[model samples]
Target: MSLFLGTHQNRLDVKGRVSVPASFRSALRKEQTKENHSLIFRPSHKMPCIEVWPLSIFSELTNSLDSLNLFSEEHDDIATTLYAEAWPIDPDREGRILLPDILKEHANLTDSVTFMGLGTIFQIWEPIAAIERCKAARHKVQQKTLAVPPKATKKGVEL
Candidate 1:
């Protein structure tokens, strides 16, 4: 699997289009979808950021719903949460995707956006908010004294 890594910042144009990082585009291309430029944009459930997922990954992500009882409220809630916010997108030849007004508003996006790589996924954040989130994450780590877990050996657990 191609993992998205590093931080990239891009300018949002008047028409709400932003260029995806070259590295990210390369990573996404490796997914080998039928439509090369196809992508999906959705507001992140956690932070004030938009998430970019290739169609293949997005389809696989929805597979988890299979384990849920079809008639349950929990299933309905999760479905609504995921499907309701999803928007299909296609990057133009310049490797730019249009940030729809709804998602842009949800992420509180400004003139510039920060793409924070999260391994199998990536997030688009407002530059200031991304910086603030980083600071808070670091502070949270420093505030906690975490106990390290035992490492797993090839044959068994290791302390």
Candidate 2:
């Protein structure tokens, strides 16, 4: 129903290509109004992973950036960094995308890579790296006493 909802593992071929997951491919197809279904692949600013976003999402980001005061230091910094790291990607006929050297180096990806779903965007992670991150996150959550809000009914009463 939505884009990038699950984890998938795929291998990079000798030519540095890896297949996009089938569900992700189908999602991309729906967004297709032109000949090519393209994406922006870049290094994750927060992690050692590749961040993948549709062109439309990047367009929306640019639109939001346009609304920002051009002279603002934060805007200038983000605009510079985002545009510098992103790459426009097109998958081949076989639904494989060629990973660039910089991105691969950043993620430490060799033969195997894991695609992790994040609703609007997805991440390419080394499988072991992904596993370690997941474990660490779970452990961190377990150490915290997070409060859960009570469920609400239509009448706004807690249930």
Candidate 3:
């Protein structure tokens, strides 16, 4: 799995294009399974930002969704929500992708864009909004101590 870490900020050009951060691009390269790697962008239902999913992770999501009964309301709703406005984007040689107008408007992206790394997935946000979200997230987690259990190695040792 790709491990994306750290936050990056970049300018949004007048042409509606923004460069994906170098670190994020490096992570994406590690996750690539084809000559041309693509990213899936979807408006975040839970936040004012655009959620980016590496194709591999998105495939896993689809596979899990397939477990649901076909055409059932639950399945249909989830599929529609995920696919209806999803945009598959290929970053150019310059590591820039054109930000879709709808996505920009959804996130209220203006002069600058902020990239927030979250392991297998990441998010694009408007700078100010991103800062606000970080504050809120930190505040929420301040009252709790959360940690992921270590994974076991091949020799049955925890890591």
Candidate 4:
């Protein structure tokens, strides 16, 4: 129900807590019961970032991953990395979640952080890392767009 999408940069407090952006918090509330809204955090395999998911979404993702053959090398690697890094957490009364210290260190998170909403899940990034990543991504998109020009349409077409 919480179809979140977009990026928001925020700061973490001294206690290792980050306030869920207003839009993301509202979206998460829509997906879970009022009394039991939960969140999980884990290190991202692709980057120096953390992945955050609602309890419901996390369960759904884990269930899908469960169908994989755990004996296979690929599955074993994924399982070990994901499970070893995962941390289940819930927000405090003030609507902030405590990020694990190890995870924070993994991402090199210091005073500033970036929260990027990606539909079913979200990512936490160190501000500098996030900026560089975004720049690189934008450049790739630009190159692709330039490589393939938009098709011309008839004047009467509704599109």
RMSD of each: 3.7, 4.5, 2.7, 6.3
Q: Where in model 2 is the C-alpha error above 4 Å?
A: 145-159
Cα lDDT for residue 35, model 1?
57
The better candidate by TM-score, 1 or 4, is: 1
User: Taking the tens digit of each residue's C-alpha lDDT, what string does model 1 give over 66-94?
Assistant: 99999999999999989998998988989
Question: On residues 78-117, what C-alpha lDDT tens digit does candidate 3 reach at each position?
Answer: 9998999899999999999998999999999998999999
Candidate 1 clash pair list: none
* Regions of candidate 4 where Cα sits further than 4 Å from its true position: 34-36, 146-159
Q: Which digits, one per residue and each the tens of the lDDT, describe model 4 over residues 1-159?
A: 667788887789888788878898889878888756778789988889999988877776777677788688878887777678799888776778888899999899998889988888999999889889889988998987755346645446633
TM-score per candidate: 0.86, 0.84, 0.90, 0.81
Prediction 3 TM-score vs. true: 0.90
Q: How many backbone clashes does candidate 4 have?
A: 0
- Superposition-based RMSD of candidate 4 using all C-alpha atoms, in angstroms: 6.3
RMSD value for candidate 3: 2.7
Candidate 2, 68-87: lDDT as tens digits: 78999989998887889899
Clashes of 3: 0
Candidates in order have lDDT scores of 0.87, 0.87, 0.89, 0.83
Q: Name the best candidate (by lDDT).
A: 3
lDDT of 3: 0.89
Q: Score residue 87 of candidate 2 by CA lDDT.
A: 96
